[model samples]
Target: MLSVYVDLALGLTVSFLLLSLLVSGLNEAVVRLLSIRSKFLWAYLRDTMDGSDAQGRSWLPANPGEVFAALPFTRDPRPQHSDQPSPAQPGELPEREDKAEDAMVKLLYQRVQEIDHPKSGRTSIANIPPGRFAVALMELAASEPDGVEGFLGKLRSMGSPLYGHLKGVWETAQRDLDRFRQGVETWFDGEMQRLSMLYKRYVKWVVAVLGLLVTLVFTMDGLEYAKTLLRDNALRASVTAVAGAGPGAYEELKARCGGDDPVRCVTETLSQPALVTMVDHALVSVSFPAEGDPVVRWNGGAWWDRITTPSHWPGFLLTYVALLFGAPFWWDVLRRVTGLRSRR
Candidate 1:
């Protein structure tokens, strides 16, 4: 019993350990894959933006003429001016030119003020209202020789450092993801192999247990058979006759008793030495009538039928306990093997 308990405990411990390893490996693989995906997304977005610093650093010139020169020719066709209109040249200014110059100066001043007081809620070319920044960049790109294609080529050649940083992270993460996936697959395969091995082992154990149970059941039947034989008066009479007891001795004993009723049968059976010896032999050989009973006589049933009756609760309980303890490990092994087969 102690050996059986130890074997069961060992089997359960191994099964739990295998399950834990498989779960932990799968969890790590999932986390690594998610991390790789996140890095990939970040790299893609950074590449798309061309690494323009997201901190709102101003790149445009403070001078109006510089701003005008930077704007596409289609938007600002006038020649750039170096200095403010002089008093002597005031009369040279056309009404439309003066208004255009005032608008340009005001736009430049607003841009400069936004740069100086960045904390103040304001917008720049990068954060142009609504879809205007997109339109402006598109216009600038289009004004170039190869339009957006040329701009993209330059951006790629320049190699945005942000993309490099993100790429490094992504590559590292991807390698880890691949390794984790391989490990998980390997772990899963190993678990399946272990389960297969354990299943075969469990089946062997089950067969042995079943054989023991069958043997115990048959032994109990044999014990009941011997008990029945001891209780048979005809058999006992023949034995007594062979032992030189007179023929009338057996016949007169039965007649005096008027037949075998419980009380009279016991009294007559106890009086015969040969019958007592035969009963003792059967009791000793069968080792039945256990400790509590110490004596068992036939009750008009076959050995198997009597053994299976309510009196055999101890044997039944023991068999049930063995099955209960062994079944879970057996079931887990079966389930794992089935899963492996389905995957294959």
Candidate 2:
């Protein structure tokens, strides 16, 4: 019994440790994968900016005057054409072109601002050309700064080389991001498979454990009956007489003792095989108390002296009933820990 208890304890401990390790490993893998994905996304965005066409050009400034001053229009102004109809006035025409250009400029300026001081508002700037937006962005990239600083300072420091480096980093990060995404997909797939396997394994273990427990319970019950026999002199005498009999004589004696109370009559008449076999079968049917039942006690005396009444059947039934009821809860916990029910 002591050896059986040790074996059961060891098995449970090992199972618990294995379950813990599997769950922890799955969690760590997922967290690390997410972290890598976040970094990859950041790198991809930076690279996209580097590859843009506005690297070394000025688009718009927080102050409109600064943008107008930065433009090359002042260096080489177009001659006046008196014959052509004057460009429509802002109030007369809707200024759609200017507004569009302003929006683009603002967008570019905001990008630069984000690269510099991340907290800057993403307001759109105006007065940018449509066809040259990409090129202007590449040129403006040079204005961004090298190291971390405020928004404008960062914009002023970015150069062509820096843009190229950022582009390279972006490409690398994109590849890594793709690979990481694939890895996560693969990992989740594998996790589902592993969780299924573990659940099946645990179910199998539960069935085996429960079966063993039932068998042990029944066997202990039989042992209890044997102990009872030791106290019942008539039953013990009947068993002893049966142990000393031959099969033919026992059959004749059983036939002669047959009656309404055949088992009792056999014990009174044959006091042998017929009586002992009946007693053994009766003993086998008796139920054992559950583990935590109050009836189970250590008397600190002879081992066989410990005896219990049949009143604790309810406790035994309740214990197994509770275990059966807890199956759903265990299943839910396993699903949550393994992310089995989560959508990708």
Candidate 3:
């Protein structure tokens, strides 16, 4: 009884680990092809810099002339005008509006563009160090005619909440340039941390969708695999033997996955023509729909029923839920389970 349970557990773990690798590889490829990380970062920075004031005034320049004047670091010297009704002069100041914010937006974009490497035909800054952000702000401040004080003057002109936060930081830094830059860096770090969380939250939905698709494409029904392992002693023993073959075999398997970088590994592995053929025979033909759960067949019921029997949805759901734990998670689980099996 103990041996049966151990073999079942080992077989299930091995199967899950293989399926996870496939899902993770495909996901990495998708992320790269779409340039999701860079796009998300660009969006966060744009929204943060361009958020409106409480009085409904935009942080972007209301005037095209002012926008052009603020573009000191931009590649193109020519003005890029939008369709706003009115254009304000650079020197014009409103009692309620902040002209300096226009400059800040321009400067922020300049920084983003400086680091914006193109991926999949889209340009965006994938990552920016907090130190670099702090440095950029300080440079903007130093460019003012009155230096830091003039910069503070611009901050004071703004009615936005960002100004209030900067006011606190400036006071805390005692008007010292180095200390102020450090404070800015700290502020940027906090914002990046929040952005990181948001990025992960959004990406999880994409991951879940991909996981479900992979589960269906391969028909990786966890419940079905478990049942098979329970019934087929030879299959269970074969899977368990492969897993317990020691660290050398495991390392060799990972090496075939394209070195250490997850993205490259996944892309390289899946791009191979041999992988499709290998998938048919690998893991006892689990991925071959014809050999397992025939996705299309003629049955006496409805077409949908023939394509997908009602009994398979539960297994598909189980596989998808397990995949959400991700490849790294399953890799660790495989290692631990194999180690335990070896010890016993």
Candidate 3 lDDT over residue span 37-95, tens digit each: 65456444543543553455432333433332332122212112222322222232223
* Per-residue lDDT over 122-239 for candidate 2, one digit per residue giving the tens place of the 0 to 100 score: 1121122222333333343333343112222333233222334334433544635334334434433454455445434433443444533432232223333333333344434444
Ranking by TM-score: 3, 2, 1
| Backbone N/Cα/C clashes per model | 0, 38, 1
Q: What's the lDDT for candidate 1?
A: 0.36
TM-score winner between candidates 1 and 3: 3
Cα lDDT of all candidates, in order?
0.36, 0.34, 0.58
Who is ahead in lDDT, 2 or 3? Answer: 3
Worst 10 residues of 3 by lDDT: 71-80
Model 3: pairs clashing at backbone N, Cα or C within 3 Å: 63-88
TM-score of 3: 0.63
Between prediction 2 and prediction 3, which has the larger TM-score?
3
